[model samples]
Target: MIQAKAPGKLYIAGEYAVTEPGYKSVLIAVDRFVTATIEDTDTECGSIHSKALHKDQVSFVRKEDKIVISDIDHAKQLKYITQAIEVFEQYVNSKNITLRHFNITIDSDLDDASGQKYGLGSSAAVLVSVLKALNEFYHMQLSNLYIYKLAVIANMKLQSLSSCGDIAVSVYTGWLVYSTFDHEWVKEQIITSTVDEVLIKNWPGLHIEPLQAPEHMKVLIGWTGSPASSHHLVSEVKRLKSDPNIFGHFLKSSQLNVEKLIQAFKTNHIEGVLDSIRKNREVIQYLDAFATVDIETPDLKKLCAIGEKYDGASKTSGAGGGDCGITIVKNDLNRENIYNEWSKNNIKPLRFSIYHGQ
Candidate 1:
């Protein structure tokens, strides 16, 4: 048997802008992970079981043309897994190798006690884990970049639109500055593209660079006690996308701040990071006004205000109607007061960092 695990991701900077090509996002790989285990089986068919997805004994078989999962319920929910297997089959077939039947087990630590997702990229983590496990199990000799691109394809197959920045951070498992692939180009090729065609294409616009948090930096994650629908919020944001003058300004400002944040990390400039985050918060606040959506809720604003009171910077982490927000402080700062204050307001601090492997 072989096992592989991948960490969930958080957006330190660049939330919405990263979706567009040429824009960058700063991402962190959190310790919470999705794990996959694979074991060869004598049966002609293969099977998958996921504890986190509440799926058991889902079966599949390889046909002359393609692999097919038998249970429709499992098939729908297991798109990433099924598509991964298909992609792996294609990869191995090109090498004139027949894949073996196996039983796969999947699990995750990205959920709460009640199984509510924490807006962490659980799907991306699971996809990365499954891809990594298969690559190791079959000795496919695939590069991490190739695995990342394949995972993005699987994710985009289900959701049509993605930056794939999450997949990059999960695969690399650390802090990174990611620029979007030419998703526009990928969308155009989908009508006549194979995995090889897509994979071989040069995405000059895509970039992923690793970085480290400044030694003086400390981050505290807080959950807003509710999960927000990222799809809905992204759709609402898209509506105003047609207004080039307004949205373009938002894009330019957001991109600049994210770049500044990266520069801050590189130079160990504490105030630069805080200032960039503050400017970023303002830009998103303008975005909420333009879209007429509550991207940053009152509770999130309260959290930021508290952080400011403690001489720190705070903002929503993702598409933020509610999921999680983070407070950035000095390493020597007192967290007890901040924790107490957040608890009183019903915000739960999530103890997480870049892939520490708990």
Candidate 2:
């Protein structure tokens, strides 16, 4: 049996703009994770079981290099898992390794006990975990970069607009400054090049750098009790591409503020970090106003206000119609106060620490 897990992630800064190639974002892997366990099967067929998805096991088989799930009705629910299997199979085949049937089980802590998502990049984590398990099962000894590339390709197969910074955080597992690769370039290369060639080649504009959080800094997360669809909000933001001025300003300003935030982290400048956070929040607000999209809900606004009142820098974490907000503070007292205020406003404070992968 082989078991592997990948952590969920939160966007600390750079959300709407990071989708564009070369635009940067900062993210942290959280303690919450999606775990995948695999066991070899003696039969020709295998099954997939996920606690977060279906209640029963879904049978599957390989059909001419593709994994086909028997339960069509629930197959879509396991798209990430199946897509990961397909991509991993490509890599395994490239190595001349013959695949065998296996039963894979998935468990997730990226959500509540009642199974509500926290918008913590659950799908990305799932794909990473599945790939990790397969990597071990085949003794592929794949590098993190290889697994990340495969995960990105699998994700792009489903959602073309994704920045895939979440996958980077999941695969690398720490605080990271990430920039998107040119998706069009990868998509085009995938058609003409083998998976091995694509993995070995340089991905234009892609970057991932790890960072150490300052000892004096504390990160606080508050849930708005309302889950937002990142895809929907991102797609809405994409519509603004029709207007070059507004969208261009959003991209440029977001890049600048994110760069400032990254520099502050590198220099251990807490004040600079806070200022950049505030500025980045303003940039997102500008985007909200012009795009006429609800990036920040009323609860998120209250959450940030309380954080600022307590002298902590705060903002909505992701695409943010409603999900989680992050608050960065210098001390525990301010964090406690922000949590108290969040509780008073019906916001749930998630006690998740930064997850550094083993």
Off by over 4 Å in 1: 188-193, 356-358
| Per-residue lDDT of model 2, residues 1-358, tens digit only | 9999999999999998889988999999999999999999998899999887755898999998789998898788989999999999998898899998999999999998777889999999999999999999999899999999999989988989789999999999989999999989999988888888899999999999999877689899999989998889999999998999999988999999999998888898889999999999999999999766699889999999999999999999989999999999987877777888899999999999999988
Best candidate, lDDT-wise? 2
- Candidate 1 weakest lDDT stretch, 10 residues: 183-192
lDDT of 1 by residue, 228-310 (tens): 88888888877888999888998999999998999999998888888898888888888888776799998888888787788
**How many residue pairs of model 1 clash at the backbone?**
0
Residue 183 of model 2, lDDT score: 89
Clash-forming residue pairs, model 1: none
